[model samples]
Target: MNLARGSSDDSGSLLWGLGAIALYALISYGLDYRARARRGSRHPAREALHDLKDREEPQSPRHRIVSRVIMIGGGVLTGLVAYTTSGTLRAVAAGLTAVVAVTAWAYYDHRTETRDSAG
Candidate 1:
């Protein structure tokens, strides 16, 4: 599929869209893993950054669900903007933006089991 031309087929574009979402998810997961694995390092600056990525702020289960919902909404909004305003190039940029934004947000906000919530 030639994404440069912005494939005329809706099916092709839909697949690309789903692929973008999955890519973002994978990046976010990797960042979380990296932060956790390197958390014990003695470097202060790196530790501080990783701590944020490790979700230093305690979040309830409800907060986690809401954050995920909002992140999905953001991706959908940016994807629509990129597709409508430009072509495949902009769409690719949108995917990159989503990856970074989602990864950073996931660093501070994450999924927690409802059963673990004190409420």
Candidate 2:
């Protein structure tokens, strides 16, 4: 299927959409696995950071701003890429990629925070 030209068939578009969602889910799962594995290793810097946070909270306005910008930019990029091609499969895949990336990031973030708080 040529993705350069947008396909107008509803069936094709529906398939593409579903495929994209599935692909995204797979990618997110993969990221979760990697994050889980990596978390097992201890890092001195991370420990130190945790200690510092426990002792005194540091305000990171810049960090918050950067994170928000990245999240918004990433969402825009995903939408653009998903809609760029004409083929249903391609577009769906692109959209799925974006979803999975975001999902993975959230999962990793949650895990890290949970672990940190526990430790």
- The Cα local distance difference test for each model comes to 0.58, 0.52
> The CA-based lDDT of model 1 is what?
0.58
How accurate locally is residue 13 in candidate 1, as Cα lDDT from 0 to 100? 56
TM-score of each candidate?
Answer: 0.51, 0.40
Deviation in angstroms for 100 in model 2?
8.5
lDDT score, candidate 2, position 84: 49
Write one digit per residue (lDDT tens) for candidate 1, span 2-61: 766456544455555565666665665566556556766555455545553535545665
Model 2: per-residue Cα lDDT over 1-119, one tens digit each: 85654655445545554555455445544554555457673554444444323432322444434434544555555555554455565656586658755764565455555655565
Residue 41 displacement (Å), model 2: 9.4
TM-score of 2: 0.40
In the order shown, what is each candidate's alpha-carbon RMSD?
8.3, 10.1
Each candidate's clash count: 0, 4
Which sections of candidate 1 miss by over 4 Å?
1-10, 40-58, 78-91, 107-119
State the weakest 10-residue window (summed lDDT) of model 1: 110-119
